[model samples]
Target: MTTMTRAELGALGEQLAVDHLTGQGWAILARNWRCRYGELDVIATDPGTRTVVFVEVKTRSGDGFGGLAYAVPPEKVRRLRRLAGAWLVGQQSHWDEVRLDVIGVRIGRCRIPEITHLQGVG
Candidate 1:
């Protein structure tokens, strides 16, 4: 099997993350949202909790990187938090709560992508 390019892998990972979240009843608000601060991979609302979630998606192949979880370091989480706040400020809608989530995807040659979702991270 041919190896997937990094961009392709990332797109696939994000799609997987979105699929997983939606399957769990989350409504997707945005994807690849960008601002001067940074970009949010996915933004969604959890009907059950009436919360708005900002998601960070990290994609990796094999173990070249530390791991999927390691992709989101403390600094990255901090940045995501700031971006989330900025995103909220631009919107007129209000949510009961704001939450952060990280989704990691691991793809191997010809294998199904492995997805891990870490909710309420930041």
Candidate 2:
């Protein structure tokens, strides 16, 4: 089997994350949304709670860089918060609550990739 590049892996992870979220009954608002600061990987609303979630997707082939636990550092969380704020400012709709989440996708080990979703990370 051929190996996937970093970009390919990331794209696949993001798509898998989107599929996972949608499967959980969440409505996707935006994807790969960017601003001056950085990009927000995924923005979706939790249908049950009516909350907006900003998700950061980390993809890896194996347990590297300290695995999923260390995938999103404090600085990264701050950056995600800034990006989320920037995104929220341009919107007319308002959410009662906003949350930061990290989704870690581990591929190439099993037939199906493993997805770990950490909610309210920041």
TM-score (C-alpha) between model 1 and the true structure: 0.91
Clashing pairs in 1: none
| lDDT score, candidate 1, position 73 | 83
Worst 10 residues of 1 by lDDT: 105-114
Rate residue 69 of model 1 by lDDT. Answer: 67
- List candidate 1 segments past 4 Å from native: none
- Residue-wise lDDT of candidate 1 within 3-116, one digit each (tens)? 778898899889999998999999999999999988999999987997999989888877687755677889999999999998899898999999988888877764677888
Off by over 4 Å in 2: none
TM-score of each: 0.91, 0.97
Query: Looking at model 2, which ten-residue stretch has the lowest summed lDDT?
Result: 63-72
User: Candidate 2's residue-wise lDDT over 1-122, tens digit each?
Assistant: 68999999999999999999999999999999999998999999998896999999999888778867688889998899999999999999999899998899999779899999999999
Residue 63 CA error for candidate 1 (Å)? 2.6
